[model samples]
Target: MQRWPVLLFLAWVCFLFFAGIGLFMSGFLLTRIELASSSSCSDPLVPPPWERQSLPPGSCWAPQRFAKAVLVIIDALSFEFAHFNPAKTSPLPYENKLSFLHRLATSQPRHARLYRFRADPPTATMQRIKGLTTGSLPTFIDVGSNFATYAIQEDNLAVRQAGRVVFMGDDTWEGLFPKKFFRSYFFPSFNVKDLHTVDDGILQHLYPTGKHGEWDVLIAHFLGVDHCGHKHGPDHPEMAKKLTQMNEMLRSLVDHLGNDTLLLVAGDHGMTETGDHGGDSEKEVNLCCCVLSKFLIPPLPLQEPEAVPQVNLVPTVALLLGVPIPYSNIGEVMAELFSGDGDAVSAALQQLSVYHINAKQVRPTVGLPIELEKRRNVFLSTDLFCLVQVGWGHDVIFVGSLH
Candidate 1:
């Protein structure tokens, strides 16, 4: 009886052992299959040499040299929307006190430059962000496939901002730059009816990011302004509240940022007077772009207040952070921001144009020589920087207003 029990126990052990081996083999095979399927012809991690083009001599991405950056994107912020001059808009004394953004831009040791940015319409959030980040023109096809998920195959500035990049707010960026950030917090962009939650949700992470000091780039995309624009027009009661929140947050961010870190704030696109977009009306296409850095020379409105194309920022930010311009970029670099050697600034622009031509990415009106000429002009000018005129490409009455 004892021998029979022992034999039964031995049989059970053998069964368990076989089951374990089978599980291990199955797992091993699945992993191999998964790896095979996921593998790409060109690994983004280790791209081809041609794809990794060199920047100009001194313009390579070195966050160590420039310190890290904090990009605050306030969606649908128009020229008047962010205006805090007290001369314009209502509610008089109460609003301007909270509106340090007004003082920040206009004050001495001025860290801000407010510009009327000309955005490409279909000025939808995705399209604007694509232009802002990739420095590429998003076409009719992009608008047609706005909802579709597309992997970013072209060289992007994110590759330069790759390590330790933290993103919060506006889930749209995740789709725009999938698998890119080290840590991210994405909230629903569609929930416009419930206005405050998305902005508030992103607010929690803001100071903590400043405290930790680990992230090389901290991107905070506030959706409150856009949500307010959608749910209630620019003049709605809630809009004031939202602006107050943004103002407070901006002050906090300024306090928290290291001397090395640059603070860049801009709208993805502007809202119309009636609070809607996707048209070329001055209010809709015209938005504000502001950059604050101790390294920057004072006298806000950097260049006598002219309209710059939204795509221009892609190379501007990349150059500041020591990254190559996105390969497909057609916009000219904002060389005026740098007080460095004009030769190096011009060289960076030339390199960017050359790379675009080599990669065959220049499109429509802007060509390599046209881009290089602007660079050369900026290079040659004694005082005034060269200005490359921007071309327009949007239907006048493109979309029905949200109103």
Candidate 2:
């Protein structure tokens, strides 16, 4: 070979080596980023909006009236993802179907509610999870170690009130709740060599025959889809394969549970190409709620049919449980879903709004008084309340009261 060709070939090989290295490093960092901000279950220092108040048991109104148990699964879910893709993603063909997911999305007695939020700069699993569990976004951007903290700690008065709560997932599941509270069953993430075995352990515990009414609240996190998405992007065949597996697993469990148990299937956060989150990507997060029982409330009209966001989820689940909507939750309960009675739900929602506004008015304990004034305009602009103008767009001031 000529000296020049040899040199060129050598250079090309060196370039390819570094390029491969770069890609691997990027994937590693992306995986770590997703796990760090999105998957951890502990609450951050500032806490999210929903985590602001711990409702004393039975403080609001509704408590375990509609359904006996609650099941929450956060999909590769972004608030923006749900807003963008209201219709279901195209399903795989017969041999490749996600039977459980497909059934949940399309079946009767299974109502799906899409919630839209007014918050800006939406992104990340932890933030969305905080919003779902608490009713508001996290006060600070980087708070919350995982979803369990929001479920057990924070202001999860509903979970506390439940007769029993069971959480199943990877190692992160262990961190979401305090050991003293709900009985937690954990499985390591799919990245572990024996991921399926861990899942089996969980399924066995949850579906042990002859064991009835074991748990009042059950939250299971399936990591296969999320893991595959992170490792191979959302559109990849591997991702779809994992989703199919998850669907099958869920369907089997649901069949085992039968009518007495209500199955809720949802995603924690969605993923985009480039394998990264924390930005307002349309695919960053999307969640779907599928109720397995015939007793669920029917669907309700979407306020702004065009702008479906994710924060609406908290209110929907609260309504399903017949729990009084908290004062801070902005979304309305699907009136159609209530068993021919919406008065109590409506009244409870009003009270929740009152509580939210009242809570905001209280002086801040952590920040300086001057800082509060500086941020007043920003706070007022939030979806929590609006400043109205009389006559012309002048003499603007906050208006509206629940009482």
The top-ranked prediction according to lDDT is 1
Q: Candidate 2, which ten residues in sequence have the lowest lDDT sum?
A: 31-40
Model 1 clash count equals 2
Off by over 4 Å in 1: 1-65, 89-98, 143-148, 159-162, 298-305, 340-403
- Clash count list over all predictions: 2, 35
lDDT of 2 by residue, 214-333 (tens): 665677665555555566665566655655566566656665564445555555555566545656555554344444553544444344244334444555555445454333333334
| RMSD from true fold, candidate 1 | 18.1
Model 2's lDDT to the true fold? 0.46
Candidate 1 lDDT by residue in tens digits, 48-85: 33335543444443222355878889998876766666
lDDT of each: 0.63, 0.46
Number of residue pairs clashing in candidate 2, backbone atoms closer than 3 angstroms, sequence gap of 3 or more or interchain: 35
Instruction: Give TM-scores for every candidate, taking all chains together and pairing residue i with residue i.
Output: 0.67, 0.57
